[model samples]
Target: MTFELLEKLENKINQAVETIALLQMEIEELKEDKANLAGKTEQLQSDNDRLNAEHQQWQERLSALVGKIEQAEENA
Candidate 1:
């Protein structure tokens, strides 16, 4: 092969290698982001569950108070 042709091929190979390296770095970054998102999702789910329990408790307490109020009114 001509020296000029060989030089061109080498330059192309170098470019391809650089591109692959950059893509690998991006993949690593995306993986880290995915892990962070997963953790945040888990935390959000836990918070939602706790909030639901608290809401149910409040509902039960309010119902009990309403029942007492109704009974008092009837007695009066």
Candidate 2:
């Protein structure tokens, strides 16, 4: 092969290697992002569950209070 052809091949090989390196870095970044999102999702679900439990407790208390008030009025 001519010197010029060999130089072109070497340049192409170098470009391919650089492209591979960039792609690998991007994959690592994406993996990290996925892990972070998963953790956030778990936290949000836990918060929702806690809030639901509190709401249910309040609802039960309010229902009991209303029953007592109604009974008192009926007796009066």
Per-prediction TM-score to the true structure, in the order listed: 0.91, 0.82
Tens digit per residue, CA lDDT, model 1, 1-76: 6999999999999999999999999999999999999999999999999999999999999999999999999999
Candidate 1 residue-pair clash tally: 0
For residues 1-76, could you state the per-residue lDDT of candidate 2 as single tens digits? 6999999999999999999999999999999999999999999999999999999999999999999999999999
CA lDDT, every model vs. true structure:
1.00, 0.99
RMSD of each: 1.2, 1.7
The lowest-lDDT stretch of 10 consecutive residues in candidate 2 is 1-10
- Candidate 1 regions off by >4 Å? none
